[model samples]
Target chain A: MAVWLRSLRYAAILLAFTTSAYAESDPIGYVKTHAGAAFVDAGGETLEAFPGLALREGDVIRTGDDGRLGLTLLDNTVMSVGPNAELVVEEYLFRPGEGELGLGVRLLRGTMQFISGVIAKLRPEAVKVRTTTGTIGVRGTRFLVKVED
Target chain B: MAQRSGMHGGNLLLAALVAGLAVSACAPKSWVVLLPNEDGSTGRIIVSGPEGQAEVAEAGTAASLDTAVPETFDVSRGEIDTTFGDALQAQPSPPAVFRLYFELGGTQLTPESAALLQDVLNEVGARPGADLSIVGHTDTAGAAADNEALGLERAHFVRDRIIAAGLKLDRISTESHGEGNLLVPTADDVSEPRNRRVEIVVR
Candidate 1:
C-alpha cells in the first residue's frame, strides 16, 4: 500500500507539471543587461532579474533604488528602465506573416528609454506607450520618458 | 482709496513674476524627449494627454506629460544626462541582421553567403545571453505550399549549422516565409536570387 501511494503521488506531480507547461505561453523577450536590484513579476511569482531571464507578455518589470535593466524583444524592440521603475508589457503580438503586429507597454513610474523596432517600422500606429497622464504614439524612433512620483 | 488699490495690484504682479521664475528654474517632473536615430534622422512622436496633443519631431525636444495641455520645451544635454543617466546606461546593444542567399531550388548557400557564415558566428559569440531568429524565404518558382516546405528546409539547414557550431538549440527560433515575402518582388513563377535568402536576426 505504501508503494502504491508513492507511485500515485508521482503521477499527480507529473500531471501538474505538464498542465502548467501547456498553459504557459512562449517568452516574448529576454533581459539582456542588468545592474543592481531588478525584479520581474511574472505568472504570480517574483523572479530576480538576470541577464538571460525570459520575459512574458504580461510581465511587470520593476527596479529598486539602484537597479537598472535592459531587454530586447523578438521583434528587436529595445527597452531599458532606471531605478524605482515599474513597467508592464500590457500586450505584444508579432506574427508578421499572418499580418498581426502590436506592441503596448505601460509605465507606472520612474524612467525608461524606448527604441522602436521592426514592428513599429512595419506598422507605426500599432505601437504605443502609456503613462498615467499621457500616451505616446511611436513613429519608428528612439525616445526617453520619465514618470515622477 | 485709489492709491491703495494700485499698490495691491502691483503686489499681485510681483507674486506672479516670482511664480514664473520658480517654474522656469526646474524642468517638468514627468516628460518625454525625442532622440535622433543611429542613422542621424529624427523621427516624430505624438503625445496625447487629457487636455490636448503635442507633436515632437526634432531631437532634444520634449513634452510635458502631466500638464493641462501638451507643453513642448527643449531639454539641454546636461539635463538629459542628469535625468536619464541610469536608463541610458542600461540600454542594450541593438540587434543585428544578416542575409544569406541560397542557390536555386536547394538549401545549399551561395558562395558569398557560405563565406559570410563566419561573421554570423562571431556576432553570436560577442553578445552575452544572445538569441537568434532565422527566417527563410523562397523565390516564386513553385507552388506556394511546396515553397513553404522548401523554406523551412532551408531554415533548418542553417539552424543545424549553427547548432553544430556548439550553440544551444533552445535559443534559436526558425520560421519560413516562403515566397509570400519576397525581397525582390516578381511575377509568379519568376525566379529572383535575392528572394531565395534567409535572414538571421541576432539579438
Candidate 2:
C-alpha cells in the first residue's frame, strides 16, 4: 500500500508538471526589441528581456531606469515601453473564428506607446488599457500614455 | 495707515504667488495622447477616470488621466518627442501580411502564388525574432466540416514550406477559418476563388 501511494503521488506530480509546461509553451506574442535593462516575469520565472522572447498572458514586463522594450502580439498589436516602466498584459483572447477578441493591459508606472491591431479592429469595445487612476478605451488606433510616480 | 496698507498689499501678492504654485503642483501628472495611424487616419479613445469621462478623437490631442474631470488639450510635438522618444524608438517593425491563393479544392498553390513564395520567405528573413500566423480560409463549397479540415490542410502546407525555409516550427501558428469567414461573402456551395486563400501575417 505504501508503494502504491508513492507511485500515485509521483503520477500526480508528473501530471501537474506537464500541464504547467504546456501552458507556458503557448505564447501569445514575442519580444522584438530591447535595450538596457529589460525583463519579463512569466509564470513566476523572471527572464531577461531579449529579442524573440515569447510572452504569455499574465506576464509582467519591467524596464530599469535606462531600459526600453518593444513587443508584438500574435494579433499584430505593437507595444513599447520606456524606462522605469512596469506593464502587465492582464488579459488576452484572440480566437476570431469563435468571435472571441479582447486585449487588456495595465500600466503600473512610466510611459508606453500602443498600436492597435486586428483584435481592436474586429471588436473595439473589447480593448482597454488601464492605469491606476484611469482606463482607456481604444478604438483601433495608436496612442501614447504616461503614468507618473 | 498708508504704510500699513502697503504692507497688506505686499502680503496679498505673496499669498497669490503661493496659491499659483500650489495649483501648478496639483496639475495632472498622468495623461494619454492620441496619435494618427500610419495610414493618416485618426481614431478615437475614451478616457474614463474616477471623476468623469472624456473622448479624444482628434490627433495630437490629449486628456488628463488623474484629474477630477477629464479634459482635452493640444499636445505639441516637442512635448511628445521629449516624453515618448524612447518608447517610440523601441517599437518593432509593423506586421506585414500576405495572401496566397490555392488551386481549386486543393492545397496546391496557383502559379502566380507559387511565384510569390520567395517574397514571403524574404520577408520572414528580414525581421529579427519574427513570428508568423498562417490562417487558411476556403470558399463556401462542400460541407462545412470538410471545408474546415481542408483549410487546416492548406495551412499546414504553407507552414511546412515556411519551416523548410529555416524558420523554427514553434515560431509559426496555423489555424483554419474554413468557410465560416469568407473574404467574399457568398451563398453556400459557391466557388469563390478569392476566398480560397491562406493569409500569412509576419510579425
Alpha-carbon lDDT, every model: 0.89, 0.89
Candidate 1 on B75-181: residue-level lDDT in tens?
Answer: 76545665787998899889999999999999999999999988898888887788899989999999999999999999999999988887778789999999989
The sequence of per-residue lDDT tens digits that candidate 2 reaches over residues B1-203 is 00112235556556556544543544467899999888889999999988899999999898999886787777655556657878988899899889999988999999999999889999999988899989999999899999999999999999999999999888898999899888999999999999999999999
Candidate 2 Cα misplacement greater than 4 A, ranges: A1-25, B1-27
Residue A69, model 2, lDDT:
95
Q: What clash count does candidate 2 reach? A: 0
Model 1 regions lying over 4 Å from their true place: A1-23, B1-26
TM-score of chain B of 1: 0.84
How many residue pairs collide in each prediction? 0, 0
Model 1: per-residue Cα lDDT at residue B198: 93
